[model samples]
Target: MPDIKKAGNIPTSMLAVASLLLSAPSFAEVYVAPFGGYSFGASEFNIKSSGVGNLASDEEGELKVSESAQYGVMLGFTTTDPGDIYLLYSHQSTELRTGNNFSPSPITDLDLDYLHLGGSLYFPKGDVKPYVTASVGLTSMRPSGEYANETRFSMGFGVGVAYQVAPSFSVFADARGYATFISSDSTLFCNGGDCLWSISSDIMWQGQVNLGLKLTF
Candidate 1:
């Protein structure tokens, strides 16, 4: 397991915000939503020799993650107005294909998951509501086949629109951008005695667009 000491602070902040919202002096409306969407991103992996005297050379590769479907659930609380607080969990499965000089034959499958705490301000106009949201969370990255897994802190913001179809049900669409703060020298993929590569970015960015149904009670 990787040291998640740095990732601990984000959850604390999220909890504080949730507590504040829950303690507000108003009647709160609770809701649950299930959503599905597409996720797309790009990451760079750099490989270097780490042994005693074996042609030391550094090679870099770019992994372009293909657009893939993602799904999640959200639980929320709203006051009398259009402002609400929510907790969300989402999952995405994608493929990482090599770019530049790297071979593109074998694509590595990646599982990405996020747990976020967020708030949104909605502008209600008749039956349509347009909203903006910001969130802080943690993201887990797991690569299948031959790569190490890691968890990192992340933050994001989005804009969305919701349409009320009935008294209790509404349909919504959201587009968000998230950036995970991974350590620059963190190991991304490795093989025993053959190769080892670390991620070369201070942050990795991912974009998502989703459509979902929200039920309020």
Candidate 2:
């Protein structure tokens, strides 16, 4: 397991601040949400190694993470009727296929994970609540090999609606856009002595939609 420090200091600082606010005297409620959904995106990877002498090198390829399963958990604190803060962790299993050829074999399994500190503003209307959320966090990309893994700064924005189903439980659906910023000369997908590719990109984006059950206390 890679250290959280590798993800950088910004996400850590935001989590600490949110934790402090959650412990304040005016905090109204604490809630837990478990969610599962589908995620899709076009995360482009550019080849950077000059000596590989392959057509794939020095060219751009897309990691088409399409319609993959994603799941997560959130721990939240509500301070007022319309305001809350939360920490979230999500895991996504995606298929990495060549951009040009959509083949059945040679499909690589990729894992995309995130940890975020976020806030939400809710509009309460009768028994339903609609909300908008934003977060800053860390994104980790791991391939199913001895590949070079990466952790980068990430941020997201989302909108959702929640319907109260019971006294202390609610069901919700959310859709969010998450992106990670990558630098040039980052190695990826390695094994044994040689790496599959090195990538250079300014940003990698993903779209996620989730259905969840929230429990309040």
On residues 60-149, what C-alpha lDDT tens digit does candidate 1 reach at each position? 566656778999998888866668888889998887676555566545688889988889999999999999999998998778866567
The regions of model 1 sitting more than 4 angstroms off are: 1-26, 43-57, 190-195
Candidate 2 on 1-217: residue-level lDDT in tens?
A: 2354665665566557555655656546788899999887656665544334243444555444556789999887776757678888999887666554223344567888998889899998988999999999899878776667768999999999999898789999999999888776766555556776667767888889999999988
RMSD of 2: 5.3
Predicted structure with the largest TM-score when compared to the true one: 2
Task: Return the TM-score for candidate 2, rounded to 2 decimals.
Answer: 0.80
lDDT, candidate 2, equals: 0.77
RMSD of each: 6.2, 5.3
Model 2 segments beyond 4 Å from truth? Answer: 1-22, 48-60, 101-107, 189-194
At residue 68, give the lDDT of candidate 2.
Answer: 77
| Per-model lDDT | 0.77, 0.77
